[model samples]
Target: MPEGYEDVCAEQAVVEGGLLGVKVGGEPVVLSRVGGQIYAIGGICTHKPASLEEGTIEGGSVRCPRHGGCFDIRTGEAVRPPATRAVPTYEVKVEGGRVLVGRRAG
Candidate 1:
């Protein structure tokens, strides 16, 4: 984990279509609750700087609002075209109503 950083309580209810964007380590991180687990990924779409928070959250994936690219929220894998590269994904854990994201392990 990065120094001087910790988990932040984003939301209690992670409905099927709920999405939350948070700033961590000076970077925008998108947190989506799917199947009762929190998945953290890069908030910005790889195809553009468009915020994923404004995108659609459905079928356990987030679609880029600017370009129509799709990505799996759990794995951060590109699921559709217009975005060939995959975004960064983080490990998330929930404790005491707080959502904690660990540093990307090497």
Candidate 2:
């Protein structure tokens, strides 16, 4: 575990197709529960200042409502137009019924 990054909340708090915005270690992150798996990505869209939490999630991707672009919730890949940069993806873990999000492990 990284210093200053700790458990945020329980897994059950995030429902399927749900979007949540949280800050861990001063970094804004958007957490999404897709099909039963949780994915964490940088909160804002690359092309605009819109929050990804306002977008819709389908399958493993999330679409930004502001610019109509999409990002792969898994790899953070910018899968659509207007977004050429991939958002950062954090490592997410569920332990003791809590969801812990943090930086990528080495």
- Which candidate comes out best when scored by lDDT? 2
Prediction 1 TM-score vs. true: 0.86
Report the Cα lDDT for candidate 1: 0.78
Name the runs in model 2 displaced over 4 angstroms: 1-4
Which lDDT value does model 2 have at 1? 44
lDDT of 2: 0.85
lDDT of each: 0.78, 0.85
- Find the candidate with the highest TM-score and give its number: 2
- In candidate 2, position 9 carries an lDDT of 77
